[model samples]
Target chain A: MGKPPPISNRVRLHRMLAGDMTQAELGEAVGVTRHTIIAIEQGRYSPSLETAFRIARLFDVGVEDVFGWEEQP
Target chain B: MYQDLSFREKSAWAMGALALIITLFYLADVQPISWRTGEAPPVDRHFIKIAIATIVGSIIIQSVLAARNPKEAEAPADERERLALARAGNHAGFILAFGSVAALLHYLVHANGDLLFHGILISLLVSTIAESALQIFYFRRGG
Candidate 1:
C-alpha cells in the first residue's frame, strides 16, 4: 500500500450522522464512485476541492469540519 | 470477488490477462523459429493471427464486463480513477522509452533490421502489459 495522504477526514462519521448513508449514496450525491468515497473515508485518497465542498455541503458541515490535516511527527 | 471490484478494475484485470496471453503466444510462435534459424523470424501470417486474436479477445472481454455491469461501464471515470489512470500512463511511458532505447541500442550493435523490428514489437507488448499492471496497482493502492 502507498503511504496515506496527510489529510484526514470524518466522511464516515458524517455518513453515519446523515441517516446512516452508504458510500454509494454519498458518491452519487458528489458525482463520484463508491470506491472514491471509501478512499476518502480511509484517507487513502484526497478529494479535489470541488468534491470536498460537495461532500461537506451534503453533510451540512463546513469543509473544515469534515476534513483536517494530520500532524506530522 | 468481482462484485467488490469496480468496473475499471475488472477491465484492467481482464485486459492484463489478455495481453499476457497474447505476449506469451507471440513469443512461443516466434522464438522457436528464431532459435532454429539463428536470426529473428520474419513477420508473417502468425503476426496476422496474433492481431486478429487480440482484437477479437478484447471485444469479447469488454463486452462481457460491460454486460455484467452496464451502469458502471457507462459511467465516466471519476476523479480518483482518472488520477490513477494518468499515473499509470506516466509510468508506462517510462517503460516504453526504456525498452525502445534498449532495442535501438541492440540494433546499433547487431545491425539486423529484422531483430530490431521484433525487439521493438516485444517492447511494445511488454509495455502494454506493464501499463495494465500499473493501473491495477494505482487503483488498489490509491494514486
Candidate 2:
C-alpha cells in the first residue's frame, strides 16, 4: 500500500459546520466515492494532492483551512 | 493490521479451498496405477481425465460462488486490490517458471516425457496456490 499522509480533523469539523453535509454529496463534488469520503474524514485514507485541492475548492476554503498539519508534540 | 476483510478476501479464501480439494481429487482418483504385470510402469492416461474434471468442476464452483454476490464478483478491481493482485501474480509466475524449468531439466536427464508433463502440471498447481495465499496475505496487510 502507498504511504498515507497525516490526518486532519478539519474536514470532519467543516462538514459538520456545513449543516452536517452528507459524505455522499461531498464525495460527488470531490469526484470520489462516498466510502472514500468517509475514509478521509475518519483518517483511514487520505486523498491525493489534487483531490485534496478539489475538495477545498468545493468547500470555498483554503487547503490549509480544510487540513491541518498533524500535531508535532 | 487490517481488521476487516473485503468481499474479495472472502472469495479468495473460498477459491483457494476449492482449488486444493480439486487437486487432491485429481491426485487420488484420476491417477492410474502402473499396468505392467509384476514390473512397475508409467501410470495411465493422466492428462485427459484431469483436464476434463478440473475444467468442469472449477467452472461450476466458481459460477455458484460468484452468483451469490454477482456485483462484488463482477466489480472491476479497486486500486489497492489491483496492485496486490499484480504483485502476487508477478511473484507467483516466477515460482512456476523456475519450478517448470527445473523439472524439465530433470526430465531431460531421464528422457521422460510423462515426468515432464506431470512436473509442469504440478508447477501450475503450486502457482495457483501461491497466488491465492499471497492475495490473502496482502488483504490482511492492508493492500
The TM-score of the first chain in every model comes to: 0.95, 0.80
- Tens digits of lDDT, candidate 2, B1-143: 22244557766776677667766765664344423332222254455666776688678767876787586567666554666678888988998999899889988798777667767787887788788888877654444
Q: Deviation in angstroms for B5 in model 2? A: 3.9
Candidate 2 positional error at B77, Å? 0.6
Ten residues in a row with the worst lDDT in model 1 chain B? Answer: B38-47
| Top candidate when judged by TM-score against the true structure | 1
User: Which portions of model 2 miss their true places by more than 4 Å?
Assistant: A1-73, B1-4, B29-45
What would the per-residue lDDT of candidate 2 be over residues A9-59, giving only the tens digit for each residue? Answer: 478777887788888778767766554566677665556678789888877
Worst 10 residues of 2 chain B by lDDT: B33-42
lDDT of 1 by residue, B49-109 (tens): 7789999999999999999999999999999999999998888888888888888998899
